[model samples]
Target chain A: MTASPTPTDAPPLPWTCPFCALLCDGVALARGETLELRGSDCPKARQALAQQPADTAAATPTIDGRAASLDEALDAAARLLAGATLPLFAGLATDVAGIRSLYALASARDAILDHLLGDAIMASVRPLQDRGVYYTTLAEVRTRADLIVCFGTRPAERYPEFFRRIAPGEPRRREIVFVGTDTDPAAAGPDTELEAVPFAGDAFDTLALLNALAADRALAAPPPGPLAGLAARLQAARYAVIVWEPGASGAQGALVGEAINRLVGTLNARTRAASLALGGSQGGYTANQVVTWLSGLPLRTGLFRDGLRHDPWALATARVLAGRNADLLLWVSSFDPSATPPAADLPTIILGHAAMPPVAGAPQVFIPVATPGIGAAGHLFRLDGGVVVPLVQARDDGLPTVAAIAGAIAQRLAAPASGAGS
Target chain B: MSAPAAVFELRLRALPRFRVDLAGVTPLALGALGEAEAGRVAIRHGNEALALGELFEIRRRPANAPALHFEGDLSRFDRLAWEMEDGEIRVDGPVGHYAAARLRGGLVAVAGDAGGFAACEMAGGELAVAGSVGDFAAAALPGSMDGMRGGTLVVRGDAGARFADRMRRGTAFVFGNAGDFFASRLVAGTIALGGRCGAHPGWAMRRGTLVFAGETPAVPATFVETGHDLRVIWTLLARDLARAGGPFTALPDRRVRRFAGDIAVDGKGEWLLPE
Candidate 1:
């Protein structure tokens, strides 16, 4: 049996740029209109963007799989939602603003507006919004941090350029350390320690590390060779960082958060510490600065019990979805809703921009708006507790701001609520 | 090195400064001023402990030192306060985790994504997303729970899993998407998505909001919407979100709808629909 030549003997695909969720930001266009796969970015074109096989997404997604006029596509989408009884207003989540618009439509129409993250992360985000906490961002890490740790997370594919901006060789360097198994081979550098602990005992590994360094005692997996010595290094570090990658199964996710608190508690005893997410591995999306500026909450609430409660389970988005609660669906998402309750069937109304490769099903009325980061100007809060990034909205066909749209809608809804607000 | 303490001024982008700490100090506790007290007010380092000027040339506070700049070797540091009340700090290169931990005010544009716990337990700040971030990018520390209180964490790119696990409050947004089991144990918060997210995000989330901007398969634990999207009031929140920097900031004055629940957790959470 001839196995044929490997990629070494074959030619490469055109190009794939995972710059956006559509994973269509930078794609390869062949001379014959037959596009080739781009590099690492196009996971769906290679791996999978929305559970749809790479080959499935590689079919050149269009509303109907055919190149139709822009108007025709919009009309078709409108038709789908108009006639759909159980229409779910879904977003591709390629861009945050686009999906938000769809969410508006979902809210107005009581449809399901969701994307991948909506399902994977939002479950917890819903409740967290009801609570609150403190944090920072990547921009802050660039020049501020001195220590970094890779927990149950990896930053390889999602943001390949991640290392270049924060590593030692850069104009402003920071320390690095790995606490999980040797998953990200590229993360290891001469200056940092990439320890390979038993993947199973990750929670215990973290506790053990903290105990040995912070409490001056051994806990789990006594850490061998360089790791044992690394404990002393960690304890002595003036500014230290910790990173953990939960890996494929996602078995250690729960422990990651607790481990972090413990690590920070211990590290704060001497040196300073900070953290960031590896890529798509997170539960909630930090809202723009305004949300927090006013209510001290993200999309939910922020009245914590002294110690900010970032617990989503407590708020119960699932219960809300199933209970058919909420007088209105205010989906102010930077992206699309990532989750859908098993029994969710709500009337969705949309009020934001529309992301392309629309979510499955249709909405009653879908209005496309401006891509905030691209068409308007605003302020966004970074992951770090207090960093605020100025948003530069690009003027695209003169669309009103999401705020304006929402304001107008609010005015309309308030008409009845206040009996005369409108 | 002219403008010593310029309050309420955001002078970034044009020209920034990076000031390194000569002495090892917990930058998180120490304000940006303490970290930047180089030149005139230096700290104790190794040997004789030189001043900030001795170790790294202080650009001086700059008649307008564009807020932030890169100073010394930060390879041995942590808790780089990327978030300043006002002003900027430029890290010419890579930095550590909690890069700008607990940032509450100001603009921080990172050239790269930070390490794990990058923005754990943050309150209020605008963290730019030029690159990507690690696990819990804007979430809480592993055991000692508590997600970002109130802040915005935007990721221009994708991220690893467990993004905002055990989050109590705040919103963590991703321009791209993330890996699996993302918001598993979320407490309360709103997680919006711009891209397709990974799998098993809200496994055991009790109460929180999960928004999917991209297409994804259905989750078994999650029940379909039992109610509907609340278009009218939803616009208010959506508007606020957009103005706050969401891509949908420019949506029209339409209605909003709502859906709810992870049947497992009382089924109270929801998905806001747009019309």
Candidate 2:
């Protein structure tokens, strides 16, 4: 609804947004007759835009799913969701401003809001959440931390600049330790220690190592090579950091969680320990941010119930499909649709943005929206914890902002309930 | 009353074997803990720390039988109480593995399920779990020959595989259906199942009993039924479990079937089933 590119003859500057983990920052788009999407010099964005359907299809969505008057599409999306019992409005991290709108909608519906990495984010923060530890920003890692531990995760696979960010700046001689999975030590840059521990199916192995270390025992154990010595080193460290991937530990519950957090807290009792969540999905932090801000708990909370209940083995779509918890899946992801849905058998309603394919039973509602960095200008918080970066703009028009769409939907939804203020 | 010194607070983070300022503190004062801050934080002794938030999250104060109340996702925090002396702890969410690892005394009640090593190496204490626990619960630490010794461990819901491996002493019971590998080496203790029991239960038992009250999967490998009874112990256990919130606590009038286990051994251990 903003002024059209003024019918300029030359191409207009594209707006880039880094809200999503993608950080695809420059793109050119507009709506003359049909919605158009253009990517900057970014290869991935160009490929995605080119893959968009030449024109809008009858059933499936194209580059312009919300081509209809933004008001009309938002109204339909809102009215449809407002009446459902299991309404789940999620995947709002793409645009920070839109998060406010999402909060409004979720409150109004009393619905379950989730993201791709529900369990992972919660698990990453579980230890600190339970034992009452301090919260540190990524800036701490870049400066204060002398040693960094990445257990069962590789940041390069997603956040390409992870090493540069965490190991960048002052002293530059910081040491990095990667544990759990096997990795070629040479690949990680200078002086980084990569310890390979045979992958066990469960996290109790870590506990075993801790026990060996804390007890100063070493009888040629596999996972815990030199427990006693390790414990001593850990206890004597000035500021040691331990980090693990989300799935490194299984799901969370009441008791086991307390036990795990206690373990972490005990380890950190003598030193400083913090975690770096890779991302919500492949490495996105939006899901983590959204879930924390809303439920006062992490993702995978059974907010669908009156109070936010936590049943990891149950609530997850996969677990539910595994015949662990209730049915009727409501999946929300900010990625391509044709991509795999965690639980294939359960009936689902997949809400996402991207030129992706459709999954069976899970009715795919394609939401044509702007790419964080490539299509719009906005602030993008990275997964290093809190790395808020301003996205450079590149797109011209027709690219509806994710925040704008979320806002319209919230407005339409609140119309029936609280009216104006809502 | 003489003016009491101002209360000091400490926020508890979700970490196993987590030790804080409450070493000599009373439960009445401990119950003031909560989960509010972001990133696994808790309030503690005014001095700001990590994990959860500031100490004394709970605002209310209660007398006698004071309890330490925890509010947050405790799945990562293990060892609910390590050699606890006294008092009680109530967690709002599921706890991580080894909840109550080596619990010495007092009541540790969880609003949700627990993790592995539940009451592991427990010398003396009482733990009540509303949900199921992970493997090796109430069992000894890996490589340790003995399991629970002194204390009572009760699980209201089902348990994972290997319910109780190497039991030494004490009593461990489940109200609902039990998991696989019910009981391994019965050194000297009692494991009573109110519902179905898992396979290979009571294997290599020197003494002690593994009881099944409901439908079982494959009762096998050196275990035979003994006799039925409505003894005073059953009445006492039923009353206690019921009062602790059991589905059949109010109806303890029914007869309890007794199944003697590992006849190869002394066979003094007996499993109590609902007749």
Candidate 3:
């Protein structure tokens, strides 16, 4: 692979930060001894870039904690998969191409596929499945939302550039309300008015009141003062968007999502309103989309010889690991080095970031792969689940992409073994 | 009705290391196969394909009806009797998720606890579990429009959350306690609970009848008390449930206080609290 122009001798390149789900493409990055951010000073982008030094040593593949050739590692992985009674393919933190290839391998090996953030992703998905949703994209929120309600989360904490990304180009009056949470200082602008409402009871209780009030239901007792005002404002707004982060919603986040959907549905009856979910970071959406389109089922589905079966709760990564339901685990994490596989006694194979530290255990094969947007060009679905953002490679690290490694393993699994191989 | 004599009995040889998919191994399907052919029938064990004989010891017996009996700790087995159109299936031990899902017509009985999504989206059948069940029992499949369109589901023990979610049509009886969001977003159905239940029962329900036969649950703020004139409706439902025999046998003698309105959606659903 040819190397791109280094930052020491060239100007900062227009870059898309793959650190978060926002995938902020408005920034420029200069790669020198340490990565420098220009145009936008998002701390998350800086922190992520700081982890990837300009002149870091490349990682090599290993078998059973000892150094091995890539071909040798692939062969060992294929052997493990072939013998596995149930192989779980998880930690899917790679781009679109990586998930596509992994799905093919999952089908070939009859593996059960799930993302590391499956729980958070399911928080949004469960509601969409139970009752349909009225959702809006980031662009829609940026251009047309007159009233914005951040429910149970401060988006800027995880997504540093969320407020900046949605800052309206033309100055117009916008009311920003925070429910069951404090208002984000980042949301303060010249034309923005902010307010916060305390929860009526718990989240469920509060949402129940809100849904009832929005639908004009005559409650025996009057609703909470702030919630009633918020409902009235929601009805009055020209275009309203309710922003929620599923990861922040706790164990019963799906219920929170459903409540948000109910509120949105009720408001849409009278006026314009929609919800914006902030999650699916680290290629969660990419894997879900790819798996769904390929097999007509979402993640946490098993491609059995009998047929496909999808059980979100039973097939959760934590549940599966606790039950020892799977005998082998194939974990792929190419974006973040800190994202490691959970401790399990099963035979494990990891296709991960080049800078990832050695994981402790035997009967494991570790193959370091290229990080998309940093070392190789790729595409990722944005948090809004609408647009696919093109990721530009900042450098050529010469590490094979996850797609290549997974594809190679699939090839090895399909091919007839040579005499005395393994 | 007394238990139909089992035409085929499948006893587990050993505990499987991985979950087995017993979806197509229904009574009618297995009854047609000879002893040798039945043993060779393919089933999924984890990711690998295995013959039925590898996992179970199959014994055939002459019977009048198409029936199959499973004897083992089948907690690692999933999709049991899935999509079975007609026949009788019985399990002596616990079964995993999606058991008897989409069952069009049949009788599925489990003596032990059932895993999540048990009898999910069942169109028509009679499913009875002697023990408890996990979440989403008789609920819709993920992204599906309706749940338990038609059937009779009776859980003698407790039930988990989201029970009968989006159920359009069915008559379900949970004789023990239930978790939160019971009968949530219910389109239309008749569900009876014989014990205490968790919060938010009958939430966002458009149409349905929820009968709390044991303990009256605290009604949500969205629902309001209505006149107690539903005796005609209650008598019709009670007659059928009483015949099923269990906690529901005493339901006919009880008077009920009625409440209506999830008003958040369509507020026509009713919750009958036994007084």
| DockQ, all models | 0.01, 0.03, 0.52
Native-to-model Cα distance after best TM-score fit, residue A320 in candidate 1, in Å: 2.5
Supply the DockQ value of model 2.
Answer: 0.03
TM-score of chain B in each prediction: 0.71, 0.71, 0.95
User: Which whole-number lDDT from 0 to 100 does residue B241 have in model 1?
Assistant: 57
* Candidate 3 chain B weakest lDDT stretch, 10 residues: B1-10
Candidate 1, residue A211: how far the Cα is off, in Å: 3.6
Put down candidate 2 lDDT per residue, B75-189, tens digits, no spaces.
6554556667667777877776667777788888887998777887788889889888887777765346678887988998987766776778888878887665577556777
- The reply for model 2, stretches above 4 Å from the true place, is A1-72, A90-93, A133-137, A170-174, A185-187, A191-203, A215-229, A251-264, A267-273, A281-284, A294-332, A335-351, A359-365, A414-422, B1-275
lDDT tens readout by residue for model 1, B1-275: 33344222212222112122222222222224533553445443211233544444544332333354544334323356634444455554445456666676555556665555566677777666556776666766423557676777777777677787666777777767787767756777787665666655665466777766555435432334435545554665666656545444543354544445443343455554444
| Cα-lDDT of candidate 3 | 0.87
Model 3 over residues B79-162: C-alpha lDDT tens digits? 898999888999999998888889999899999999988888999998999999999999988788898899889999999998
lDDT of each: 0.44, 0.52, 0.87
Error of 3 at B261 (Å): 2.5
Two-way TM-score contest, 1 vs 3, winner: 3
lDDT of 1 by residue, A1-422 (tens): 11212233244423322222112222342211122343433343332223222221222213423444334434444444343332332323223333344334434443333333333333223222323212335545555666566554555555454554355544444445555545465655555545543332444433434444454543323445555555566667665565433233144443444445555665666766644433232112323223233334333221221222222321234433443333223233322223221333443333333342333332222344444433344443332324433444322334445555544443443344433211
